[model samples]
Target: MGGQENVDYSIVICTYNPDENVLKRCLQAVRQLNVANISTEVILVDNNSKVRVQDLPYIKEYTAGIPGLKQLFVVKQGLLYARLAAIAEAKGAQIVFFDDDNEPESEYLQELHRLNKQFPNVAAWGPGNVEVDFVDGVDDNIREVALQLFQHRTATTVGFAAIKDWQPCYPYGTGLCIKTDLCREYLQQVNQGRLTLTGRNGNKLSSGEDTQMIMLCISKGYAAGISPALRLTHIITAKRANRPYMNRLLYGTRSCYETCMVQVFPERKQMLESKLISGAKFSRQTLKKFLKTKWNRSPQKTFDLIQFIAAHASDYMALDKPLPGFVNKVLTSLKIV
Candidate 1:
């Protein structure tokens, strides 16, 4: 049921109120990518965007000549929902989840295909060269933090060993190339309202949907890894490097990680409860650090550190709030929420 389909690759680009200029760059990258003999399809999902993607002049200007380019509008708001909406429509045996900011190398598809053929158990694969292109004002520290903010990891993780580089990431969502059947299975989980974590939605800056899917595959003895040859550049903006944005990004990411943690480790319920009980103590320590570091080294660093600590506490305390999603429903069912 996978590669039996005619299409070789279905490139799914789901965007929500994206930067038009960067989105244009992404489309251009796709247009220029060397597909050669690959039967590729491009699916653009407008995730209820404020500015419809098709309305953008570049929609015609850039993607006009490209074949198999289709426009899809996902009424749902979340990034995961957008991908899920496109998955049902994808005819290709393989699907590559692309962000609007991604600029793939010419051989992106060729490289992924090469690796997939080399490793059949690989359910989801990504590009290793997928990285952040920081804007001007970014120094080394800020750039590092910004990369962390986006979960762009350079380390290549192929299987269960992939869990080590989980610095809030496994393989990034930018150029995630996955098998169709695995994508369908993940989509089914989404349809059943299982996974409580939703990926980035709008400008909220949260994540975890990617990791959950990969982890699910791993649980089933499938591998999630990277093809070093396939490359993609993530266009960065100054806003993502700012202190306030980092605070929100890290805070939301913390919630994402905790939610995914519960799903991936259902037996850790008692541990999560302990974290909830000690949340106040953690918050107090974070406040103390904030007070001391307010006048210390880089205010942004000091403040971001505080947010990192407080984010964990916040997720712990909010363990009671009912949300629309849950990862492992059986485990979460016993939650006191």
Candidate 2:
């Protein structure tokens, strides 16, 4: 299923229930990537999917032609667990992460390989994404926000740029490539209850795991940046454009910000709280929108925001002390569908 113990790159693609046609196209794109003699392996970790891999037409039909392709089913639900499993099994110095929906360019692998060679001791780097809105009737305003949500851009520099200050720490998980050693280090912190957000377990969208990892790496003297050499097409279908998912996305984004701040700014505990309190409250219109569908408040929205604030508040209280059960529980909790 994979190459020798030492490979130039191990491309990890983690997924839940994926669109079959898009999956085929992505696999085909992977099959066509120009590794150019760089030892590589493509590991597809099915994260507790309901669909059997054996029954998936794309797995049987499309990936037969994809060399270095390995399929591993992860019964664990969260993306963090799937990724932990992937890191344990990965045999590459650099592991490039790709989402199932991303169609990386022909030179994606080669460029990542080049970047790894270029930036020694670099933790991770990723190319910006081109968003392909796959839904009709998406208004310009919605499209604008969706573009920012899906696309990861670097303003300071695009190619091998060192992160001198704390800006957007890393790219989104799509087309994000990291060194295997750093991935292991990041997971160790996750085990220790430091970084939160940035994982998907079924319906729970507590995210920023990617950002947290890169931020942690930077704190430990690792170099990370946005690379222009690599590129991928990130597909956002109509389903994600709906109201419920949009709310989840917004909540997850803020939740991730809170957790990441907790990890990186443990000293500014009171200061963080002040900022949160001083921040603008939810508008009347926004609250009405949350209440329109139901007589009461939206439980999902309420819980998500509560968790977000609690995460930061808990960390603020903890300071250097160990975080208790409650903070980590909500961070990793699965939504009871």
Candidate 3:
């Protein structure tokens, strides 16, 4: 019932209490997409935001003016739940999931179309997320450049995986795309409560939902790639740049391991073994990098890297036993539940 002949693409954005200006800017970016053979439809899924998003000015503008744009469905659930709802309602052959806080460059949609055409077997694609520090009104070019260098140095880093096909160890939900039919089938499984978005009670910060989806697609013989050409600026507030948030981001990585083992892995023994080996390798590599860095580096950057590695180590240690309950407890204490 959701399919319609006119629609070629569906842009699904899941948001909860998103900054109004940022959300509007994101929509504006989508509006700037180069419209050609493919017609675009936007599906905005609101996850019970305290602020009424529909009341935002730009939403009204789009609802009133844009012709290529389709319906904006508002679902009052958590991010994953809202994403599932949007997937169900999407009418396009291809569905792109975007974060409300992200503003894409003009070539965003164009690159996806180009990549899909180049690799028809691909089930998923992602763009490099450039961070924009809003408080200072400055782009984190240093971070971006460092990230690029890191990705070039390693094959597994998320940024590197965006430019080529790699067995994605994790999924970055921001600016990721999947075929609509596959998304529907996957969400149906999730709705049946078989595969969950793991990490805890709907906290947006936790990892694994996107990674799990990509892994499922891979298991089904579908391909996934990162289109280096498509880029988006992920707006970052000062709060998100702080050490506490960095630590949470680290702990969040561990949740990815737990989720993979508990939700996707078929055999406990195999899963534990795989988790431990992968975790140990990641930890070792991280420690090696950490120790090699110069002491003259910025204190903030050093602390961030240290916390990130610590989180990875903690994640590896967690894999020593089955501790889904413990993972949930941590999420609960963080009020992520």
Best by lDDT: 1
Q: What's each prediction's clash count?
A: 3, 3, 1
Can you write out model 3's per-residue Cα lDDT over 1-337, one digit (the tens) per residue? 3765567788887777777667777778777777666788888777777766777666878545444454444544666677777787888888888787777788887778887887777788777445453543323534443333112212233332322222443236677788887887778778788676642223345655776676666656776766557677776555454534544554554445544544545544454455453534564555455454455455445445544544444444435443334433433543333
TM-score of each: 0.83, 0.77, 0.73
lDDT of 1 at 13: 91
Where does candidate 1 have its weakest 10-residue lDDT segment? 327-336
Cα lDDT tens digits, model 2, 146-187, are: 566566454445544345334554566778888777777787
Off by over 4 Å in 1: 1-4, 135-141, 151-169, 270-277, 303-307, 314-337
How large is the C-alpha RMSD of every model relative to the true structure?
6.3, 6.1, 6.3
Q: By the TM-score metric, which is better: model 2 or model 3?
A: 2
Compared with the true structure, all predictions reach lDDT values of 0.70, 0.66, 0.61
Better-scoring candidate (lDDT), 1 or 3: 1
Runs in model 2 deviating more than 4 A are 1-4, 135-137, 152-169, 196-198, 268-270, 273-337
Clashing pairs in 2: 198-207, 198-208, 198-209
Please give the distance, in angstroms, between residue 128's alpha carbon in candidate 3 and its true position after superposition: 4.1
